[model samples]
Structures are given as structure tokens and as C-alpha cells.
Target: MKRIFALFILLSAVFLTACGEDEGNAGSSGEKDTINFGATAGPYSDMVTQAIAPLLEEKGYEVTNKEFTDYVQPNKALANGDLDANLFQHKIYLDSFAEENNLELSEVIIVPTAPMGIYSNKYEDIDSVEKGSTMGVPNDPTNLARALIVLEDEGLVKINEDVDPLRASLADIEDNPKSLDFVEVEAGQLPRLVDSEDLAAVPGNYALAAKMDLLDALALEDMPDDYRNRVVVNTEDIDAPYVKDIKEVIESDEFEEIIDEEFQGFGKPKWMEEE
Candidate 1:
């Protein structure tokens, strides 16, 4: 009878240990000592490797970066607790993605982001863009709108004033003063169009991946603050210690100094600029 009682106690202890682990790991990958960070395979990933990870290491945190070639996987990874945090998407995209996926995620902080730009192999400047020239724009709705807004800013096109600029599309163009012909292509494939199209509107990330200089573009989009890429985590882990640590590392002067030195053409987020 004493042996039977002892076995019961041992089983109960093991069950309790398993329950505690489940509760602790409910919202993230079961490790607190190491962070699983995800980003698209480009400048943003470089930001994590070059700037953020060193400071996180100083705090005794190990950062493991996962480079995804496309946009869909990062958030999916975060939602499934395969990643603790990620840094390649803007707040707008994060909100939209979370809503669509029914995932609870939140932005911890925004980071300096590369802006979309108008690149040309033939033209030296916006003024040199010939009328009726072919322009390559992102086929994806979000970035297509961004490209249109940049065109409107450069007086190349006029979008309908009634539409929200964020939702603007080729159909929303009320006027084509330059008679510019827009070719819609995948955003990543845009940099390749630079040599073929008269002008190509390339998102900053893709341009950097293609080794094109941001400053070399004829014009860069003046993006809204929310459009800047942000560090994101599961909303359940929004108040986690590691999230707080990530924010602290980003807000430090060391992060900005690294940005100025390495990420020169990237635009600063409003929070950083306000300081």
C-alpha cells in the first residue's frame, strides 16, 4: 500500500510539471532565453543581424533569425508560436494580416524602413521621364497604391481625389497627364524591370535586395508613419519581458547610430524622429 501511494504521488508530480510547462509556453515558443525572430530575406533581416541582435546579446538574450523569402510565412510563424517576434512588416500590414488570419498580434515598436522609390535606367531625374513612358508598379494592391501616390507626388498622374490614397489603384487614376503606361508586376520582381521599363517603382526592401541604392532613385515615397516596418509579437506576449527588452534596445542611441552608418537611405519612423 505504501508503494502504491508513492507511485500516485510521483504520477501527480509529473502531471503538474507538464501542466506548468503548457501554461508557460501557451503564447510563444517554449524558450525565454532565446528569441525566434523572423524577417523577409533582405534589408530588414540585415537590420536584425547587424543592429538589434548585438544589443540583445548584451542583455543575455540569444536571437535566432529566420529569413523568409516571402511575406506570408512570418506572421503565420508568429501566430503559431514558432516565432517570438518578427520585424519585416509595417503596422498596416500587421493589422490587416492579423485580422485576416484571426491571429492576435500587436506591434511592439516601429523601425526605420526603406521607402519605395522610382528607379530608372534611362532617366536621370523625374524631369527626364518622357511622356507616355512605360512604368512598372507593384501588382499587389497595397504597394500599387503607394506607387500611384508617388506618381501623383511627381505630377506624373492624378488619382481620383474621392478615393483614399491608401486604396488607390490603376482604376482610380482620374488623369494621366504624362500619359504614363503602368505595368503591374510582383513587387520583388520590380527591380528587374529597371533595365527594361522606362521607370520602375520598387519597394525599398526589394531594391536593397537587388543591390540598388535608394539614393539613386529619382524620387522616394514620403510614407505615412504607420507604413514604417515594426517589430511585432503575439498580442498575448505584448507585455512580455523580452518584448520590453526589444523596445529598449531599439530606443537606444546605439541603434540609431548604426542606422545612420549602415542604413543611410532608410527613413526614420515617427517615434525615432520625435526624439
Candidate 2:
């Protein structure tokens, strides 16, 4: 009788322990309480994962970093609920992308703008650039307009006042004093053209990827007060706790320090403040 009682007690204890273990495992089975962030594979994404992710993790939120190569998929993932948010793209690009794709994504925060620059292997300086030299610019509509605007600002070319910044093309150029040859190439291919073309207006990311010194570029666009840098999320998730946490972490002093230290004047955050 004593042996039977002892065996029954042991069996009861073992069953209780098993039940507890199962409950704990079940509680942790589904998606973690994580903020899924999407970014392109570049300094921008690296900096965020290194400087920003750890901070959020310290606050008890898991961080998942998703890398994208193209411009469209990140926003699409956010809109489709595959991602919690995205860190790439500026407001201009985001708005245009949404309009084109029929997405209803919204900007949750403005992070930083990578000042666009024009790089060349042939000319030592912008003044040394001769008239009629071939110039390679991004073929994308928005960037094409931006490149033309920069040229216009430098008195290198003149564009019609009626030309839309998002749709401007070579046909919109009203004047080209040097008979400059404007070559339209895909954005990714523009960096490769630097070896052949007299000048190329390259995005900052591409310039960095090509290992070119950003400071060596002959000209950089003034991106201050430009609505071209932002992080976006679906409208439904804008008010989520994790999304709010991400916004705070991005706007924190830590993130700013990382940007200043890593980018060395190339990237800077521009967060909106409450009045």
C-alpha cells in the first residue's frame, strides 16, 4: 500500500510538470511581439539594424529586419500586411509609388534624406565640364526631373516652367548651351556609366555602393525641407504600440548619433515636432 501511494504521487507530479511545459510552449508558438522592418541593402539599412534595432530590443520588442533590392516591394509588403513597417523611400517616392500601385500606405516618420549628387570620372570640376559632353541621368521619371532641376539650378540647362517634376523628360529642356548630350539610363545603370560618360547624376545609395567618395562629387542637391525622406506604414498600423515605439527609437538621440557618426554629413534625420 505504501509503495503504491508513492508511485501514484510521483505520477501526479510528472503529469503536472508536463502540463506546465506544454502551456509555456503554446504561449510562445505564434509570431513574436516583434516589429518587422523592411529596408534596402545599403548603409541605410545597416545603420538602422545596428543602431536602432538593439534599442528597440532593449525595450522588450523583437526586431525583424527585411532586406529588399528593388524600390517597390517594401511598400507593397507593408500595404499587404506582410511587414509591420518600412524604412526606405522618401515622401515623394512613397506617394508616387502608392498612387501607381493603388496602395493606401502613409508616412509614419521622416528619417533622413540622402542628398543626390552628380559624379564624373572625366571632369575634375563642374566648371571644367565642356559643352556637348555626354551626361548620364536616371531614366526614372522622378529622378530624371530632379536631375534636370539640379542642372537648371546650376544654369547648365533650362526646363519649361510647366513641366511636372514627377514627369519631366529630355524633351522638356528648353535650353542646352553646351549642346550637352543627355543620356537616360536606368538608375542602377547610371553608376556604371560614370566610366564612360562625362557626367552622371547618381543617387547617394548607388554612389556609396560604387565605392565613390560622396564628397568628390561636383554637385549635391539641397535636400533641406524636402519631403523626400520618410518611413512609412499602413494606416491601420500607424497607431500600433510597436509602430509608436519604432518612431520614438528613430527620433531618439541614439539614432541621430549613429547617423552623424556613420554617415559623416551624408545622412541626417528630419523628424516632425508637435507644435
Candidate 3:
């Protein structure tokens, strides 16, 4: 009987250990818990909280959004394990940011973004800008190309047609009819300085956040499908089931409602427009 009692205790110990492990992992991969995501502290934050979070919770994820004031911290948090994912940037900004920082970050799904444009507080139109006027463009490669393309389209400048628009830069400008002085500026700073500069190329996100008029743009780009806003996750996590769930949530009808209601000035989805 003593031997039988000892065997019972042994079996009970194994059962208890298994139960402990199951409980410990309950809210992790086995089930969904709080997913800590990051975004810039405006439309991105509002959209995630109002749209993405509710959808995620329906699939069993408790969503928590971390809002940052600038572009740098969201990626940094994602890279450092402080965030599970981020949704503030498009593929172009992500590619440049990831490459320069050596983070193997990649996109999961595309979302609508504010269409990019050149806005001037001083000039009523692009035609009014005098020669030698100094215009501010984003210093980053992707946005700089966008600004250059808009200028090129407006007949103020000529870019080497041989260069892909995605990869074009100041160096690709083959002609400058206005002899406009192109100044490289930080993207976040563009909205505030539009009044001071001859003209400034601004991203839709920042402009919307700053309450600038998207309709008042002197020139706006046709947002290529490649530049659409996307949710980014570390490459290692790209194949994770939770990441797939996040992608599903973003593409759901619930999110579509939020897009229609909240993003009136954000321009149309790039997919809706043809090349």
C-alpha cells in the first residue's frame, strides 16, 4: 500500500508540472494576450485604437498601442522587443529606415495613407515661385524622390527619365527651370516651416497630423501601390500566426469602416487607382 501511495504522488507531480506549463503559456502563442504595437501619435494611433485593436481582441488578442511623437522610436521599439509590431510607415520609409539601422524589418499588409504633396504658404501656385527660391524637401531618399518627381511634373525641374522614380534624387535632376534651391529637411519639420520656406514637400501623415489642408497642395503625387502605408514586423516574426491574424484584422470589414469614416482627407487607397 505504501508503494502504491508513492506511485500516486509521482503521477500527481507530473500532472501538476504539465498544468503549470500550460497556464504559463496560455496567453502567449497558445492563446492571444496583449499585443504591444507602436505608431506615431496621431491618425496612426487613433486608427489602431479605434479600428485595429477591437478587431484583434475579437480574435483573442488584447491590444495595447504605444504612441510616439516622431518617426524613429516606433521602429526602435519594434527592433528592441518593446513592441510586437508597428503601423506608422510605408514601404519606402521602412526600407530606408531598416537598411540604415540593420533591422530585418518587413511589411505584412498595406493600408491607406495621406497622399504626399508639395505645399507652399507663400505662393498661391507652383507657377508663382521665382527662380532661386529655396524649397524644402525631405532629406530621406524615398521622400526626396517624391518631391523631385512632383517638381519635375510641375515643369519646375527635370529629372533623368532613365532613373526610376522610386530611386531618383537631387543628383537625378537634369534641369531646373526655376533654379530653385533645394534644401533637405527632416520630414516632421516640414509642416511647421512651410510658411518660411518657398515651398515644402510633406508626407500625408505629418500634414494631416498638423492639420494642413491636403486639398491645398500645389502638387500631389499619385500614391504608388509600393508607397502605401503598411504594418511592419521583424522578418523572423513575418511567418508567425499572430502576425497573420494582425494582417487579417487590418484587411477586415471593420477596418474598412474606420478607413471610410476617419480618413476623409487621406486620399484614396493606392490599389483603387491604376498606374
Deviation from truth (RMSD, Å), model 1: 4.1
* lDDT of each candidate versus the true structure: 0.91, 0.77, 0.83
TM-score of each: 0.86, 0.79, 0.76
Q: Name the better of 1 and 3 by lDDT.
A: 1
Clashes, model 2: 1
Q: Write the per-residue lDDT of candidate 3 for residues 37-66, one digit (tens) a residue.
A: 898888888878888988998987778999
- Tens digits of per-residue lDDT for model 2, 25-78: 233443236678889888668866887788899877777889999888888888
Error of 2 at 79 (Å): 3.4
Runs off by more than 4 Å, candidate 2:
1-33, 99-102, 224-227, 265-275
Ranking by lDDT: 1, 3, 2
Q: Which segments of candidate 1 are over 4 A away from where they belong?
A: 1-31
Q: Which ten residues in a row have the lowest lDDT in candidate 1?
A: 24-33
In order of TM-score, best first, we have 1, 2, 3
lDDT of 1 by residue, 1-275 (tens): 99999999999999998887677434345557678899988898999999999999998888899999888999999989899999888878888888998989998988999999999999999998888899999999999999999999999999999999999999999999889988999998999999999999999988998999999999999888778999999999998889999999999999999999999889998788899
Provide the global lDDT of candidate 3 against the true structure: 0.83
What residue pairs clash in candidate 3, if any at all?
none
